[model samples]
Target: MKSNLVHKVVGSQYPLWRTVLLIIVLILGLGQTYVSTHFYLLYNKANSQHHDVHHEYYISVTKPINTVASMSNPNANGFTNAEIKNIQNQDFVDRVGAFNPTLFRIVIEPPKGMGHQDFRTLLFLESLPNAFLDVDTTNFKWKEGDKYVPAIIPRSYLDLYNFGFAQSQGMPQVTEGMIKLFVFNLEVKGPKGSHKLQGKVVGFSDRINTLLTPESFVNWGNETLGSVSKSELPEQLLLKLKNPLSSDIGSFFEENQYEISKSDGAKAALTNLINYSSFYVWLNGIIVCALSIIILLLVVYLSIASSKTEIMQLFFLGYGVGKIALPFQKIAAIKLLMAAFISLPIGAVVAGMIVKNSAQLVPFNSAGFQLQLLLVFGALVLLICALVVLLIKVRIKRLSV
Candidate 1:
């Protein structure tokens, strides 16, 4: 048959060394690209859950208290309206929220039947705009005459009492569920005289350290019970950044002698580093893929050169270019297909190793990840094969002429 004749003549010219080299590059290219893409996806998932980097993009900025200077002017550390306006004009800042602190004295009486009836602690409460809250509490709003107040305390506060203070004092540790169920009283006192407001824990925040109520509650409390006749200016500002990793953010904060949370800065730095590394890895994979494609073209040209006489004679004998190029195209396709198959298992094993070593720092669904990788790598190989097949036909036509 004509097919059999074409296969025997062209297939014999495939150099063994060139075939092996092509396979190695293809596997290296496909496997590295898959790994880099997987890393990027995993990082995005982790950021979404933790909001440590890239997710919320909010940080609390405050001026350092100067003890000696504060004695001369108590409001020296507080942000002036002009200072806030200057920060709002910065290119990196999307918006800023001021912390509304309670200007009246607050006494938190413990819930009844907790073994210590006389237990009371002096507590400071602050609030930000509802949009600036890291934790969502639907019940955390208050208006004038509302006796019930919902409070959000930091998780670190509970941890400190449960693991440190309670243990040292031989007191019972309370869980979040237990604490939420208990009702407490906020005894607020100022020039307007003392009043008791029923308070309940609505949620716990991981991002903020201060106890938070609703902004409306803080504003109303300041107006009604504040020692001063007017509300105090904010001592701290919460900034929503356009990009947390921007160099201008650090420089601006540093120049103004403002302090940012160390944890937020470190997390953003780590995320930026990972992003740059992933891009370089992805670029390298593309280079390897390009090299492999170049090698494939070289193999086709060399094979055709060696078989130039036979190809010309076949063309003279009424054999079309497609018939002569079929065997070469099939060999290239098979090599690419084999590389794809081999890369899958290699990629899977490497991915498994990463998931195992990551130790739940990032969540992974092995089955879903593998399926995505397969679809993506398959498309890449298909495109490469299509290009190779077309190039093979053109090469054969030129040699035959």
Candidate 2:
């Protein structure tokens, strides 16, 4: 009977308790995996959204303008009219083709009290760039049988302002009458230009149109009016660049180092902006990962410590002699394996969920998701391995006689 009991105890594996403990550890591991995955996804989504918003806001603030000068007299600059036009045409083409056109700002300021309908109608007539204007519908009474007024500006004008024109044709016509029209001072350049402009709001398209007219230019005050002189004009005709991707521009400008002395400061400012935007997400991710590792290590240590009494009891129950038979190596191996296996998948799932859910909340680029997942999973695996090794070493030492 004694020998049979001993054989049963030694040969039999750990009872329900150890299995229960392992299950609990696995549950904890899975939970951590889910949370970690979710956190990573959230972080990536936040980072991408932050970058887009920063880029948009930065572009809005930094508007660039290309200046073309038309000389008063060809003899003044020792150049012919044709040469001057050629130079300006070439310069316009080169500059417009080189950089992002959408970075330019086209402001259209109609004189106060102008009806939105009339303004919109005139816009279609003039073929102006689409203008972002606030309409006060409450005060203005709508007139029946009045055609819908469309913003008017030419495709060239939109190109100049780095704006895209609507595809629809036929703008609404406005009644022929003198309305309050102001001059527009266009600012085309990025943040560097904005700084140079010193917060000066450029004249609107309507204002520029009013001022450019032969009669209007002649009547304008001399002090407030200026024209592009031919002498300072460039050779290239400025045409808008087709695509505005940073990478595309980078590739285009690879050979030609178009150095802007002022861009250094602007670049530094942009870096700071990006850092500020992404700081919170980065910090949170770090904290969560750290906490997870610490909790996992603590659980492993407690499990090892608690298993000692049970392991010794099993040894005596299997053998006649009341001898300590704690197989520390096997127990430690199990603990290490369990900790690692449990933590990895849980972290990955959590990170994935977080990323997927965050996409719903913000504009996320799907292309980046897989890359992020791979990076995060790799990090989690490394972390769990490191923790398991450390815990196993400590447990083995404690069990050694």
Q: Which one wins on lDDT?
A: 1
Backbone clash total, candidate 1:
0
Write one digit per residue (lDDT tens) for candidate 1, span 1-401: 87888788766887677678878987877677666556655655555555543555667888898988777777878899999999999998889998988888889987667667888998888998877776676888788787678899999999999999999999899999988888897898888777888899989887777889888887777778866424367898888777777788889989999998877767656666666676677677767777877877787788888888888888888889898899888888888888878987887688668867674665534446556656766777788889999999998877765
- Best by TM-score, which number? 1
RMSD of each: 2.7, 16.1
lDDT of 2 at 381: 55
**Residue 133 of candidate 2: its Cα lDDT?**
15
Residue 146, candidate 1: C-alpha displacement in angstroms = 2.3
Which residue segments of model 1 deviate by more than 4 Å?
Answer: 45-54, 228-231, 308-321, 364-367, 394-401
Residue 67, model 1: Cα distance from true site in angstroms: 2.0
